[model samples]
Target chain A: MTETGEPEIDLLSHYARSLGIEVSGFEDGVPVLCVSGIDAIEGRPGHFHGGATSGLMETAAYALLRLALHERGEQAQLKPINITVQFLAAAKKEPLFAKARITKLGRRSANVTVEAWQEERDRPRASAVMNVMIARSEPEAT
Target chain B: MEKEAPHRDPANVFDPEKAAPFLFAGGHPGWLGLTYLGHGEDWTEIRLPWREELMGDDVRRVIASGPIFSMLDMGGGIAIWTRARRFVPIATLDMRVDYQRPAGERADVIARCECYRTTRSAAFVRGIAHDGDPDDPVATMAAVYMTIGDFNPAGAKND
Candidate 1:
């Protein structure tokens, strides 16, 4: 585990890989994921697509949950139950950042909140709340 | 306050079928392989075909929720245009998505979004995503979108 108590998370999903998301570093001691808004993720002429923004938020939330589980010495898989995303501003074609925090972690589920921003962290472009189910039995590796 | 007109002028009617390709092609939606399926007066349907790179859990062959959210977002946007009868500049204010179940392996997901209500400044949308059967939805969504610019459908003329 790193100094921030986050486990080494390797994004294995194609969705995250396709977006070219990476663990750039930590912000304010919290782990942050970064992605560049390329033409593939653009919506309007010069704006980032809302869907892609949500994808980044959800992926960030999953990474946080994975770290929390690792810290607790629990082996579990996360299944998304719900996500509520709120768009605050138009995201321009630039680098985007996302971070997540676990609000509540129960035996059967976890609630996480995530935010995405560009240029500045204080002025977030979007935020989302996600509830994910925690399953103990590990599935067969693909 | 006076009630706004429910329908935009016929001259400015927005045809979702004709606009889907232009709006989605070469963008995020196209990258995800989203395609226009069908539409109604106030509703639009779109499809997201299954792809290996989209898997959330490769073991279970389950696709990630991100693509599903993207599909719904696009569907919701198109539904708003269908209802407003014009392509008004808009932005998503909030969207709440509830996942009922993981999509089946190798099943293409279809999303149907309906714009049920609209005010002068905002439009309300609801939708469901299903793999094969519409009755057995994989996820449900409720969203709100706010209009931008001088978007007066009643007075605007189509170019």
Candidate 2:
């Protein structure tokens, strides 16, 4: 647990790491992900690809779900059920930031919302809502 | 300073198959390793092969949902272009993906997208992602794309 008593997880070793995404610490008790826009992720000329932006937001949601599970002391497999993404603005070639919040957490599923921003948090380039299915781990034999 | 917009020939028919190499060569699509499978009048298919580095959960060996989203988005966009028969500047406004099941650990995922409807400014698309079998899809997706500029097939530039 960190200063806020939230369980810490090493996200850098995940798939986002392949795209140069890194954990930038926590904000308001939520993990934030950051990624630098490079030529590999560019779409049209000077703009960031919509797919990359969506990927960043989804990764944030996954991290949030993982943190939630850890906080609840539940060991289960998390699987994505669905995800909806809205592109509000054309992402520019700059460092991007993303954070997620759990909207609902039930025994068998979870709902999470995430936002990706370039500069100001108020100005989000893209946002996403995801539903994750939780398959609880079976108790180990005594 | 104001810069000139890229030239576009609206009359040029959009051939997604022929343009696949250039479109997926150096960007996110390229990074995801999207390959052109085939295309029809208003539909296109693309594939994403499995790779260890693309796994979201290392222990589970499951691929991340992000790359799959990228693949479907590209597939959907290509479907729209094929339906419109012209390359126009368009932006994805909103997209929703439903994962029916986790993709097979060692199987390549394929997405087939169809542009079902289009208006002056918006195109509606739907698709399915499957691993070797269309009947058993890994995910389903619905999306909308909005045309940014005038649809001047003759004057639109292909970038």
Query: What are the per-model numbers of colliding residue pairs?
Result: 0, 13
Residue-level lDDT tens digits of model 2 in A64-104: 88787887888878888999999999999889999998899
lDDT tens per residue, model 1, A1-142 = 6676445765436778887777777655456988896877787668888998999899888877776787677788889999999999999989999999989999899999999999988999999999999998665799
Error of 1 at B79 (Å): 0.6
What lDDT score belongs to each candidate, Candidate 1 first?
0.84, 0.84
Query: For every model shown, what is its TM-score relative to the native structure?
Result: 0.90, 0.91
Relative to the true structure, candidate 1 reaches a TM of: 0.90
Please write out the lDDT profile of model 2 over residues B106-134, one tens digit for every residue.
67899999999887788999999999899
lDDT of 2 at A140: 90
Which runs of model 2 end up more than 4 angstroms from their true locations? A2-7, B1-9, B152-159
Output the worst ten-in-a-row residue range by lDDT, candidate 1 chain A.
A4-13
lDDT tens string, model 1, B1-159? 001222233455788777766666677887888888999989999999998888887567876899999999999999988987877778999999999999998889999999998887888999999998999999999999999854465556432
